[model samples]
Target: MAQWTVVRAQHPAELVAASHLFDGPVSHDGAADALARPGHVVLLARTPDGRDVGFVSGVEMRHPDKDPEMFLYELGVDEAWRRQGVASALLDALRDLARGLGCQGMWTGTEADNAAALATYRRAGAQVDRGSVFVVWDELDGEDVPAR
Candidate 1:
């Protein structure tokens, strides 16, 4: 198995440096904004040789009547690192961080057809809320959004 280190990204440079792990090009200003936000977090996983191989981003959500919970926004691993425990490690790291921050729980959504993702989350001890539906409103600017 390959060895890697996972660390919470502390600066925009760290996030921008791992742009390839994202779905699209990472904007430096956007990274800066996210890091500046009070409850946003980005975790990066890097190989022993310092190559970024994966990332997980999350936001801490708080409600007036409940304790804070982490909303896992996204997780990505380089194709080369899939099925090698990289994704599970990233999820574990995020869960640890959430616990440290006093979050009551953590949650994320993934397409039902994504078997790899489902397996990874299950391995990380996540319970599926099978009846929950994922809904989104995108491209409010009138541009047509492509289906994933």
Candidate 2:
């Protein structure tokens, strides 16, 4: 079984633990600061031994013309934990949090060919926006950037 945890930006230790599940190294303080910001949220899934197995991040967005909404930013599960209900649980936690904060609805986007992700989102009650195209803007080239 998996355990769910909601990490707030004010909780630095939890934020660091959640960061370990990401693909790259994350600064604990930076993560905490971001999490502390209005509308930011992170949900983590841990094993019985307390190892982080998955995590989901989201943001709350409010516009003058529309009610507040949640943007499910990302979701990831450890290879060994895939296909289980960890992802769904994490999403449910986020949804509950969003609702508590007065969000009208939640939304997330996934690649059309990513069957598992598509299925997971659908199971979580997100309607597929088939007509939408995901886009990204790359403002800088790696060659011109200084080493981190």
Candidate 3:
């Protein structure tokens, strides 16, 4: 069985680890600063033996032209724990947190080819919003960078 920890990210190491698993661990300083911002939720998941197996982060967003929402900034489970409902549990917890923070809904984007993630979100009862697309134009190359 998996156990969940709902502790504020108060240490560099903890936030660093969460960023590594949850969002590629770009920079410890930047990750810490970002997590300190308002309306951020970071949850870490561990196993009975105390291994940190997963992490999820939510960021509140209020886009000018869109409704208020909470974005799944990052959600990741270790390779050994995949497909075991860790991700789903984390998301459900995030939704509850969002609701408490006055968010109407939560949103996230995964690569179109990532069927596993799509399936997990579907299992969590989240339907695709379906109207947003990621478009990138490379000024240096003067070409459109297509989704990889």
Candidate 4:
């Protein structure tokens, strides 16, 4: 059995241990600068052998008409470690972190076609908002998205 260490990283150096688990360059100085800011959070999972296996990143959001909530930005696990509870554990840890930060709730979104993600979120006790639709405006792709 592999023991896992789940932690909320407050500094880039603390995140270096699980840098490989991230898809992009998130352990550099620029990333450190970003992590040092308020709202952003990165929760990492390390194996007993000291290998980084998974991570979940989130942000705290506040609005004029609502209480604070956490937006789960991303979640990923190493291919070899999939279905081994890494994702769920990371999410649970993030929920704890969110509550500690006084967030009233936490939410995340994934494509309806992403079975793995939907399953993981379900296992983590997330409710699906079937009535909501997700849309994006890709300005960098040169597509014009008109205001609704």
Candidate 5:
């Protein structure tokens, strides 16, 4: 049995090794934003010998006309560690953190086609809410994306 260690990383540099597991636009800017917020939780999970294996991050959410909830910002487990319950363990930690903060429930989004991710969340007891997302990008002069 492989034991795991979960640690909160306040520094982005510590997270570089595990960045590829994350799905969306994660950079220094995103890491800075997450760590700067008091309501955000950034975590790294490692094997017993200190080899990083997975990560799970989330932000506390609020709405003017609705109850508070936890928004799971990211969850990533390396291909080498997929079947050992790393992702599920990370989610359990996130849920515990959310419960500690008095959140009513938690939510997360993923690409519709990611069966592994969907199964992971489903196994962790997360409910899927169907919704639509609309994104408007900053236009570039015929290039794919404007240089930032």
Candidate 6:
């Protein structure tokens, strides 16, 4: 039972401050660019003392024939703070945000071998779409794209 507050990041400074929660280093320029985009969201879970312990980023997807849905981009929690419901809290916050934005649904992809991620998502009420497969273009213009 850890005590933390979940907040949507409205500023690049907020994202930069919580950079460590990201898989890679977050640059000020990148953070600013992300914040400027519509339908992109970044939520931070911070301790009472102002330490960022977790984060979840999502993007709203729109289709001409369908209502918008949220695509959960990434989720991370400080290793030391794991197993304390931090990730669940972050997911809950993101889910609430999606509902607030009128999204019809939310989805995310994780490797089949990632047991921890699967468990976390399942605990948050996510159902496995066994028929769904994730495909990616890891390379473009003869250069390898870094995995997020």
Best by lDDT: 6
User: How many residue pairs clash in all the candidates, one count each?
Assistant: 0, 0, 0, 0, 0, 0
Worst ten-residue run, lDDT, model 2? 1-10
**What's the true lDDT of residue 124 in model 2?**
86
Tens digits of lDDT, candidate 3, 5-64: 434455566766555475455477876777678877777776665567777888988878
For candidate 5, write residues 89-145 as lDDT tens digits.
889888988898889999887888888888899999976666756365677566877
Off by over 4 Å in 4: 14-17, 140-148
**TM-scores vs. true structure, each candidate:** 0.91, 0.83, 0.77, 0.85, 0.78, 0.92
lDDT of predicted model 5: 0.81
Candidate 4 structure lDDT = 0.84
Q: Quick one: best TM-score, which candidate?
A: 6
Cα lDDT of candidate 3 equals: 0.75
- Give me the displacement of residue 64 in model 4, in angstroms: 1.4
lDDT of 3 at 18: 52
Off by over 4 Å in 3: 1-8, 18-23, 63-67, 136-148
lDDT of 3 at 21: 72
TM-score of 6: 0.92
Residue 7 displacement (Å), model 4: 1.2
How many angstroms is residue 47 displaced in model 2 relative to the true structure, after the best TM-score fit?
Answer: 2.9
Q: Score residue 93 of candidate 4 by CA lDDT.
A: 93
Model 1: runs farther than 4 Å from truth? 142-148
The residue pairs found clashing in candidate 3 are: none
> Sorted on lDDT, highest at the top, how do the candidates line up?
6, 1, 4, 5, 2, 3
**What lDDT does the true structure give each of the candidates?**
0.91, 0.80, 0.75, 0.84, 0.81, 0.92
**Clash pairs for candidate 4:** none
